[model samples]
Target: MDVTYPSSLALALFSITLVLALFVRSLRSKKTKGQLPPGPKGWPIIGNLFQMVMNRPTHEWFHRVMADMQTEIACFRFARVHVVVVTSSEIAREVLREKDEALANRAEAYSIDLISHGYHGISFSAYGEGWKLSKKVMVTKLMSPTTLNNTLVSRTMEADNIVTYIFNLCQSGSMKKPINVRDATLTYSHAVMMRMMFGQRHFDEPAEDGGLGPKEKEHMDAIYRALDCLFGFSVADYLPFLRGWNIEGEEEEVRGAVDIINKCNDPMIRERMHLWREKGGKEKEEDWLDIVITLKDDQGMPLLTFEEIRAFCKDVNVATIDNTMNNVEWTIAEMLNHPDILKKALDELDTIVGKDRLVQESDLCKLNYIKACSRETFRLHPPNAFLPPHGAREDTTLAGYFIPKGSQILVSRPGLGRNRKMWSEPDAYKPERHLDDYSRDSMGVSMLEPDMRFVIFSTGRRGCPGTKIGATMIIMLLARLLQGFDWSLPPGASQVELVANNSNLFMAKPLLASAKPRLAPGLYPKIQV
Candidate 1:
């Protein structure tokens, strides 16, 4: 009787589990690539998704596939969607430069829509008038030198605060404790971008009112999740016929992410608009929000809805801000790795900036090594390994291959940064590559424009409009930090093996950097030149 009862209970549990498993399995059905693009072979229903993501630096695996295929560019099939892997600078130029107008548009992927609130922002918007107008507004009005200077003042103020925080942190604990440079950089950048767009960096002070508030942090977290998940093979993105493929928790994550972003940003936008009405002066006297709000000539139509304004703010905050900060962090890491390069930069900076005054825009000209270090850093670790996907507005062909309308075109930035064909000793961190006076002359620019082959900020119409300001910000921060302290890898840290494995954030950062303070008398001292 006991044996019979136990067997019966086991059979009941198995039956229940099997039924639930079958029900869950029924939720998804695989689709065919048909005429999409040529790529690696994969398992059914989930095609090529798992293999691409199983490892970090997702680009490396794809690079190996490119190597095996003997092709500079190839396409991968994720269910039915096409993902093109580009690995050449000439092809990159064709996509980003020559035929740019025909290729300036972005693919309307589902995850971007959810993370970006229905693809409403400029960074990921489809090629159209709205995107064009917003991009122009940023380039001409918001990202101008005058506006950047105003933002710089805010940045300097924040930097001073950061210095105080670091000093206090040192006083309390071991100064050698390695802080996540990504977090610190974000703190710096969020403050700058906030001031640029909204006349403030954060909603409330973290120390006084709590860092970014719990709600704000949650919202920022959603933004981060949105960024982290923005690009990847999503089953739901490809097999739309099956509207519910929760592979790797991607579907649920993106939907949850959208709700999080809206909750965080929508309220702030509402309050900002109300404040603008009450103040009733130059709506755009000092901020991007003011500029858009002040526009009476918005074609006599409602110029911008709160949704559009929110998208604009998100574009600057989420897209470009972190890109600049991460670039700075990577530069710092690379310089630390190469001592000779660091010393060269210090000597150059000491000449121009001296030891008592801060680095100024005027001094950027004489500080050649400092500028070279910036280029070398970008060479080592570009912000976006792959440029954002650009959709073909019309059908085009490259190398006797047809690129149909909607085919995704991307500039292989990371690969290009490391290409031996374009760079000598590609993996080695050497800033002297740009120091050739002839190299600088051949480039037909000052220390300002870097080697075009290393397109950290990209090029052409879609190239980062804020490139100059972004570069200046990185230079200033690095100059200030280097002047303030002689940074190095922390005790017992592997200097050689320390690679930036920051594949998880919106911008890639150095996952490992250990150093203690080497306080100097002056931070960002005056440039003697």
Candidate 2:
């Protein structure tokens, strides 16, 4: 059954095929000459798939490529898919503002489709009435100011728990040794988010039967895995001819991740529903889960189906925790790396917050410098180096370049943050720039708003719904840590790692830093709550 060609014959065939492919490509190129943006010329069938997938993380790689290309917008083909990356804030504005309606839909990803119950969730849903309805419910009902105000006490309690844990560590004579700041932030952020979402924080604790604790860890892992797979480059997705092949085993992995998430979330949704019914629908909506189970839509039907509710819950948790945790960790690492900056933050805390009591969420407004530092951190290390993939709804023109329908558009968040033309001394860590103008604060200006150059939370219609909660969590955690302790790199370790490594999406390395109590002895005592 084995039929083989001679080596010379095989080589000649490949050469002829390549020539033909190039000839065909030239014919197509002639029609769109000077229309498409400039980019790398890739091979016949694979295009830039090898360059994209072979690289550790495409975001960082793309940034470097963009720099080399010296163009704000670069276009290339990855397999059969057309990709457009926008680097400058000006182009980002055009894509997210001027042409938002035409570019509102996210690129289709098999993994996200499964997790979102066939695009039922708001994040990946196409731009239409269904998306508007879902987004309205999420913003107006689930994460409105009222809901956030109601959950303030629980969030504070979680913050207190973090302080208590650190206090205990100091008490046990672990102050001189470096602590895993990343792990601590993860625990704190997850606890805060869980309490707000599910009305409990016990998931972060150890249990005899290995109760919700183990399940919580598993759920977090599954969420991360799902994100990685959903965003990870896959050949089948781009090249339709290969859909059945499962070249990277992504299909199976995505299914397993979705199953894990659903298995953990389904029961929680059921319990919330059962409780609502058992109380004759009179149970006070204590948390997000309760609200979703009881709230009705415009049609007088349930706001979300069982599947949609679980998907929404997963989205909220992952969105809120991941960004808040990373922002806090990065902000702290930045301060540790710069003693002058750290001193300024500590001085601000002492002057405004004082050392008498722990920093409260209420104090966030008064801690202007601390807020600036956090914003600076976000500018430097956004939650994602690139905006979530967006798909063109129809043929559109972007920055004077033609973009065909369904082309995937990515806004380079990293490039925007470090844009030399926009920001002076762009690579330097200076929080003072933000402090220069507090008037923007009164206008409700924030990183989430379109006017801000930094688009970590994204822009336009599909912006993150958890923006307020995320901002609050980061500000509060940073304020508390700065107020409660004096932090520094472990002795002799001078600088914190700034360059993101290949492994993670946001953070490059784990933050290892020493913490010493700055508060009075009595103030270090755990809150009685």
Candidate 3:
């Protein structure tokens, strides 16, 4: 019994509403046109995706373009995505501090889902109560100063083992055989982390042939494959329509690697749980694994399920081992390339930590020069060239630019570290620049502060919680290595290549060097706990 309207009338009304909506949108766009940061004009639809990918690598290209345009902040478009790259310390501070609340969470990524176990870990979890709880547990149980102090014995012992292992190699032929610096550091880092986290060592003994056994290699390779997925840009990441196709097969590869890692790690976790339950949960906590399995929340419920525990532990393993190893290697490489600097570091080490005993954790605070060297290395080669992608949680403004909801934010660590305005002789490696004031700030030592001038550990709410432990690890290892051995490029290797590989985030080329013992022969004995 209703009155019928013609189809044409309904169509006319719909067309009028669409026209009005478009009119309002154009007006809003016009108001903000001049406010956006200067950037290259992109083609319609695809935007600058093709142009950026066709040019130099994404990080380098952005640096070059920002330099050419003389802009601290630049805006660009990639398909439907809006990207904002900040290259100045001032703007970085604004984004990371002033607008930190709106930009703390990471942009959506498939890898976060696959690798972080549905964003359960601290690094990739969404910014909310859950992330807060998880982070609280990590800070209190694992990264607290008291806990680090308790583990000092284990770390120092590991450092001693490394020196002993190197000495063992030298007994056969000395500097005649070049040692793989990367392999040595990686082994040391992994072993120490295993002991601290699980209360056990991964490797029982050196293989009969004195190389990593098959099982050991399998476990290490699985971790490497899983972490490698974090680097570079992927088409599936930017475009949602192509995710199902798995065009590059990244998803499948990640899944396989995760399976392998879980296979290797699950049994150890199960054993720990079994022991805890057998004791009616009365066992005193000794390590990170014990803490995660035993800690409870406000409601008297366990803070994490078994799966969540595994995922969080895995995050700690990947971040702690990978970053510490890479940072140490880069610092050494810098020293090798600059012999004068190497001599300076050695002078500092020799003066501060003598050959009477190995460098201990207590010695790190007094070694300011060594700390400077680590800072310079970070400025030059931050483990992550680009900080993890930050997104605008709501419509906001950054440096007078109109950043709509869902705009991606990229803070270029290498770019800002090398910025000419912020530093004098930014391209050159000079540790003395950080020596102006020897006082400690938020990051412990002068060199380790969380200033926007050099964001090695980033800043604000999402800053790396492991900074304190990480700084201690790098300084301690570097001090010990330089104190115990003199390093140089192997024969026929004219120079150490500093060029990075595009395949991964870390140094592309392996660091191979000849090591000659610099300590007294009598000091080479194994350290007794």
- Candidate 1: C-alpha lDDT: 0.62
lDDT of each: 0.62, 0.74, 0.74
RMSD of candidates 1 onward, in order: 7.7, 5.5, 9.0
Arrange candidates by TM-score, descending.
Answer: 2, 3, 1
Each prediction's TM-score versus the true structure: 0.82, 0.88, 0.88
Candidate number with the higher TM-score (1 or 2): 2
Candidate 2 per-residue lDDT over residues 53-91, each given as its tens digit: 555456667777878989889987875578998888888
Misplaced by over 4 Å in model 3 are 1-34, 52-56, 203-213, 278-282, 439-445, 527-529
**Alpha carbon lDDT at 142, candidate 1:** 77
Q: Please report the candidate that would top lDDT against the real structure.
A: 2
Ten contiguous residues with the weakest lDDT in model 1 = 1-10
Model 3 C-alpha lDDT per residue in residues 1-529, reported as the tens digit of each score = 0112345433543454356445445553323433666788875554676565465346667778888998888887765677889988888888888998888777666666776787887888878987888888888878998888888878877788778777777777555798778787776777677778877655445454333456556667767776766554544566565555544556666677778777777888888887775556544778888888887778977778886888787887677776777778888888888889899888877787777888888788878778888888888778766777787887788888888777788988877888888898998889878776565543435545556887667677777888878777777777877888879889997778886655444678778889888888888766332
Clashing pairs in 3: none
Candidate 1 residue spans exceeding 4 A from truth: 1-58, 206-220, 242-245, 277-284, 298-301, 437-452, 494-496, 502-529
